[model samples]
Target: MTIYGSALIVFVLMALPLYGLLLTSFQPEAVIRSRDVQFLPATLYLDHFRSVLAPGHIVPIREGIWNSVVVSTLTAAVCLIVALPAAYALSRLRLPGKNLMLGAMVSVYFLPTTIFLIPMFVLFVSWGIDDTFFSLVLAYAGFILPFEVWILKTFIDRLPREVEDAARMDGCTHLQVMRHILLPLVRPGILAGFIFAFILSWTEFLTPLIFTSDIKISTVALGMFRSTIDIQVGQQAAAAVLTLLPVALLMIVFQRLITQVLMAGADR
Candidate 1:
C-alpha cells in the first residue's frame, strides 16, 4: 500500500504539467492570456490546432514533423543494424579487451552531451554535411548506438547458449542461428531499443539546432514558438501536445515490455 501510494503520488506529480498543457492546448488564446487560470475551459477550441497546421506560419510544423519522422526512423534503423551484430559479438564471441570496450561505451553515455556538440558540429562542417538531415541522423545514431548496444547485449546475455549450440550442431551457422533463433527470442529487446532510439532522436534538440539551419525537427520548431516580445502560448501548447502524441502512444503500447526491459537492466 505504501509503495502503491508512492507510485500514485509520483505519477500525479509527473502528469500534472501534462494535464495542464493539454487543457491549455484546447483553450482559446483569449482564455490563455486571461488573468484567471481555468482548469476546465468553458468550451473546447479548435483554432489553435488550425493555426498550428495553417500554411505560411512562422514555424513549419508540418515540415518539422516530417523531418523528425524521417530522422528518428533512420536513426532507429541504423542503431539496430549496428547494435545487433556488435551485441552478439560482445555477448557470445570470445574477444580480447571486451570488458574494457564495454566500460568505454558506458563512459560515453555518462559524459555530458554538450561536450560533443561543438566538436561534432565542426566535424560536420568540415565534412560539408553541416546543414543536412544526414548529419542529424549520423549524430543521433552515434550518440544512441552505445545505449542500443548495451540494451541488446543485456537481452542476449540472458538467453541460454544451449539454443545456439543446438542450432550449430545441426549445421546452422552463426548467421543462420541469429536469423532463425536469436532474433526471434530477442524481439522484445529489439523493439525496446528501436522505440528508445526513435524517442531520443525525436526529442533531441541540440544536435538538430546546431547541424541544420533551415531543416527544423519538431523539437527545434517548438522552441521557435518563443520570442522577445510575445510567446505563442496557445499554439505552442497545441504543438507540444501534438508532438507528444507519437511518443505517448508508443509508451502506452509498449509500457509492459519497456518496463520489463528496464527492470532486467536494473537487475544486471
Candidate 2:
C-alpha cells in the first residue's frame, strides 16, 4: 500500500475507539436505551458530565481521582528509587549469586496478584495501614517492582561501562556514579517504568476493593462500580471517559519518552 494509505489505516485503527468514547460520553440515556446502537447521539446531553463533576457527585469522583493520583505517583517514585540501584548493581557490578538474585526478582512477576490479596490485606491491617493511601502505594510499588527492575536492568545492561568506570576513577562513590552517570543514561527506562507503575496503580481494582471500604480511599476504578439497582449506563460511560483523561494526558505528555524507550528496546 501507499504511505498515505498506510497512515489512513493506522489512523482508523486508533481513532475508532476514541470516536466511540467521545460519542458515548455525549449520548443521553434514552438514546443509549434505544434497541439499535447509533454512532451519533439523537440529542447531546451534558448531564452525565455535569452530574459527575457537580459537588454532590464530585466528592466520590474527586476523592477517587486523588487517591489514584497519590497512589500511582508514590508507586512510581518508590519503584524508581529502589529499582534503579538494584538494576545498576545487577547490570554493572559483579557479585556472587547475581544470577540467582535476578532470577528471584523475575520470579515475583510469575505469581498472580490475586494470590497475595488476602495476605496483603491482613498484613496491611496488622500494620494499621489498611484503608490508607500509604498501604495502596506500597502495594502498587510491590506489584510493579519486578517488572520495573527487569526492564531497567535490560536498559542498564545496554549502557557502556566506561562512563561508570570513569566516574569511579574520579573518586566517585557507587551512589555518586548511580546518581550522576547511570541515571541520566537510563532515563528512558525509568520513564517507561514510571508510566507502567502509574498505570497499574491507577487501574488496579482487586486490591483497592479488598482493602478499602471507605469512600475516602476509593479509586476511580472502584468508584466506577457504584451504580444503583437500575444501572445508569450513560453516567458510567461518562465516568469511564473522565477516568481515562489523566491516563491519556500522561501518555501525551510523555509520548516522546515512551516512544524512545520502545524504540531503544526494539533496537536491542
Candidate 3:
C-alpha cells in the first residue's frame, strides 16, 4: 500500500475505538437497550456521568479517583527511587553474588500475587496498616518494584561506562557520578519504569480487594467493580471512563517521551 494509505489505516484503527468509547459514554440507557446500536447516541444524557460522580454513590467515584491517583503516583515515585539505584548497582557494579541477587529479584516477578494475598492481609492487620492508604501504597510499591528494577536495569546496562569513568577521574564519587552523569542519560528508562509502575498500581484490583476494607483506601478499579456488582451498569461505565481519563491524558501529554522510552533498548 501507499504511505498515505498506511497512515489512513493506522488512524482509523486507533480512532475507531476511542470514538466508540466517547459515543458510549454520552449514550442514554434507552439507546443501550435498543436492539440495534448506533455509532452515535440519539439523545445525549449526562445522567450517567452525574450518577457516577454523585456523592451518594456506593463507592464515592471521585474519592476513588483521588485514591487511585495518590496510590499510583506514590507507587511510581517509590519504584523509581528504589529501582534506579538498585538497577544501576546491579548493572554497573561487580558485587559478590550479583547474578544470584538479580535472579532473586527476577524470581519475585514470577511468583503469583494470589499466593501472598492472605499472608499480606495478615501482616497488614498485624502492623495496624490495614484499611489505610499507606497499606495500599505499600502493597502497590512492592507489587511494581521487581519488574521496574528489571526493566530499568536493562536500560542502565546499555549506558556507556566511559561517562562514569570520566566522572571518577575528576575525583567524583559514585553517588556524585550517578546524580550528575548517569541520571540525565537514563531519563528515558526512568520515565518508562515510572509509567509502568503507575499503570500497574492504578489498575491493580486483587491486592486492594483483599487488604483494604475502607472506602478511603479503595482505588478506582476496585470501586468500578464494586459498582458493577450492584448492577449499576451506566454508572459503572461512567466510572470506567473516568478511570481511563488520566491514563489517556498521560499518553497524550507525554507521547514523545513514552515513545522514546519504549524504543530505547531496541537497538541492543
Candidate 4:
C-alpha cells in the first residue's frame, strides 16, 4: 500500500508539468497570458500549432528537427562503434590497472558538462570543425562513449566465456567469435546504449549553443520563442510540446527495453 501510494504520488509529480505544457499549447494566447490561472481551456485553440508548424515562422523548426535526427543518429553510431571493442577488451582481457582505468572512465562521465565545454570548443575551433554536424557528433559521441562502454561491458560480463572458448577451439578468429557468437547475445545492451546515446544527443542544448552558430538543432531552435521584446508563451508551449514528441514516442515504443536495461545496470 505504501509503495503504491508513493508510486502514484511520484507519477503525478512528474506528469503534472507535462499536463500543464500540453494544456497551454492548445489554449489561446490571451488565456495563457491573462492573470487568471487556467487548469483547463474554455475552448481549444490551435493557432499556436499552426503558427509553429507554418513555413517561414520565426523558428526554423522543420530544419531543426531534421538536423537533430542526423546529429543524434550519427552520434549513436559512432559511440557504438567505439564502445563495442572497448567493452569487449574490458570484459574479456586481463590488463594491468584495469580497475583503475574503469574507475577513471566512470569518473570522467560524472564530471560536469561545463568542464569540457570551453576546452572542446577551443579544440574544435583549432581543428576548424566548429559549427558543423560532424563536430556535434564527435562531441556527443565522446561524452556518451564511456557510458556505452560500461553498459556493453555489463552485458558482455553476463555472458559465459565457454561460448567464446568453444568457438576458438573450433578455430574461430577473435573477430569472427565476436561477430557470430557475442554480437547476437548482446543485442539488447547495444540497443539500449544506442537509444540512450541518441536521446542524450537529441536533447543537448548547451553544447550545441556554444559549438554551432548557423547550425541549430531542435532544442536550440526552440529558444526562438523568446526575444528582447516578448516571450510567445503559447507558441513556446506549443514548440515545447512538439519538441518532446519524438522522445515521447521513443519512450512509448521502447519502454520495456529501457526498463530492463536500467534494471540490469542497477542489479550489476
Cα lDDT computed for each candidate against the true fold: 0.83, 0.82, 0.83, 0.83
Give one digit per residue, the lDDT tens place, for model 4 in 229-255. 354888888877777888888888999
List model 3 lDDT by residue over 69-156, tens digit each: 8889988999899989999899888799988997897798789998877888989899998888788888888878888888898888
After superposition on all C-alphas, the RMSD of every candidate to the true structure, in Å, is 2.3, 2.8, 2.8, 2.3
**Over 4 Å off, model 4:** 1-8, 215-229
For residues 73-192, write the lDDT of model 1, one tens digit per residue. 999999999999999999998899998988899789888989999889888889898878788898899899999999999999999999899989999988999999999999988999
CA deviation > 4 Å runs, candidate 1: 1-11, 215-230
In candidate 1, the residue pairs with backbone N, CA or C atoms under 3 Å apart (3 or more residues apart, or in different chains) clash, namely none
Model 3 misses residue 237 by how many Å? 1.4
Q: Quote each prediction's TM-score.
A: 0.91, 0.86, 0.86, 0.91
lDDT of 2 at 69: 84
Superior by TM-score: candidate 2 or candidate 4:
4
Model 2 poorest 10 in a row by lDDT: 224-233
What's the residue-level lDDT of 146 in candidate 4? 83
